[model samples]
Target: MTERIAREPGRSTFIQRTRRAQLIACAIDVLAEDGYVQASLSRIAKRAGVSRGVILYHFSGRDDLLDAVVSEVYRIATEELRPTIETQSTALRAVRTFIVGSAEFYRAYPAHMAALREIVAHSRSADGTIRHSEHSRANERELSALGVLFERGKEAGEFRAFSTPIMARTIRSTLDGLLGQMRVDPGYDPVPEAHEVADIFERAMMRQSE
Candidate 1:
């Protein structure tokens, strides 16, 4: 298996990477349209206009392909949001931008977001354990980033003193909750809700006014 999966005898790394990216893109679409249970390797291959061997050549199996899908979605989202988040001078502003930025990201890459949610919800290993638990890294990073923002706000006297862990988790949960709601009710508009959530947090985090 390793030999079959190794770098093609003469294929440049760039070509290999491009092929893998294309396969992942196809996988994302299939998973989004069909859900994890229904997204067969052949289905993804048919969508990509490739043979099943092509997908197997790029990925070890379904697990590997799904993992790549989750990783790519996170990579894309971070690429979209990080620059804007860096622009905010105040920690509170960063939090607001983070939520609003996420809404923008969802709007821009609805397929990626939907595919990720589906894979996370249904992908399972042979042992029946959740297959793609690696997303915890992204979750942890968000919590830590939010923690940093809270600390900065505290230092600047912009935010009230509070348990940063709880506050960070609360904020993260609120944003994720909006997405979950949208999955159930398509009528949910996240951008406005993001703004409202940001307002609620800003007030909660801000120092009590004189």
Candidate 2:
């Protein structure tokens, strides 16, 4: 008796990358309209003008695609925020600038804010085993840039001496909270609120009370 073995599908690395990018772009569109839980591979493929099979070939499942979307969103956000952290002459200024810049980014890309809200809402219920190796590496680089800003603030005696990790998370949480509020309130204008919040945060955190 002869038995037939199934043939493995073949796709080039370049093709895989291209398809993944297409899927990520489609995910952003879907997420923008329907949020994360509603974004499906079928819908994404339809929006991208690709077949569902093509999406499945590139991503193992929804979670993988969502992770990729989130990673790309972070990359874009980091790029937008980089100038605030990199070009600032002082740490206090960096912190204030970062907060204001982040708010502007969220205002410009409301979809990113929506995606982030979905991630935070779902992360608790999702499986922890799914590996996000690439996402983690990207996050590390973004954090490192923020860390340099924090260290500079400490050197200038503008901020209290503290663990960079803790400070980074604190700053991130503050910005997230502000963005979340803005997302929910239709009347909220990010630019004015961002400047107000930045002013308050800077005064609260700066070593010199003025």
Candidate 3:
């Protein structure tokens, strides 16, 4: 297969796209089941029932393939959450929906959530720096968006005076922790935990009756 692809570099676009998607899916499965340290290109290729050359044909290298895995997972999550979050009547509803929707998304896509966490925890950049050290661009973007929601709630008098950045970070941290909990405890139910979190935040942020 690799030889064929190499010889006919101008393969049909549909075939190329399908192969890339298959490789990415295999990578995610391997990452979720085997952890980041063990999810080598060869492992992914074996899982995909293809040669390593097939992966190289589609992606530059392991990092490039992992990047695609992350991008694809996030793309799916965003599409899943957008409708629920966007249709809310108020900022508070949006915030709650975001929280619950995110948990539901994790539950629905456990493998994806696990693969993403593994990638974020282990993937490094040039110069041996952690890609998600302190806070990666992806984290910053999520925090910034959450901060906007908090600010909107405050401006509308649905929430109390508080630091939006701090609250955003707090929520993000809690959600990340929830993923960790689910990984370790088979009995753990994130939906209930998510509801608790949503309730806590709603109460904490609600405006005091004047």
**Better model by lDDT: candidate 1 vs candidate 3:** 3
Q: Rate the local accuracy (lDDT) of all candidates.
A: 0.83, 0.72, 0.84
Give me the displacement of residue 7 in model 1, in angstroms.
7.9
- The candidate scoring highest on lDDT is 3
Candidate 3 lDDT trough over 10 residues, lowest sum: 3-12
lDDT of 3 at 192: 86
Per-residue alpha-carbon lDDT of model 2 for 127-200, expressed as tens digits? 67534455556556757777887788788788876788876767677777877787688567677777887887
Candidate 3 or 1, higher TM-score: 1
Best by TM-score: 1
Which parts of model 3 are misplaced by more than 4 Å?
1-12, 124-128, 132-135
CA deviation > 4 Å runs, candidate 2: 1-16, 126-144, 162-166
Any idea what lDDT model 1 has? Answer: 0.83
**Candidate 3 lDDT (Cα, 0 to 1):** 0.84
TM-score of each: 0.88, 0.78, 0.87
Q: Say what the RMSD of model 1 is.
A: 2.9
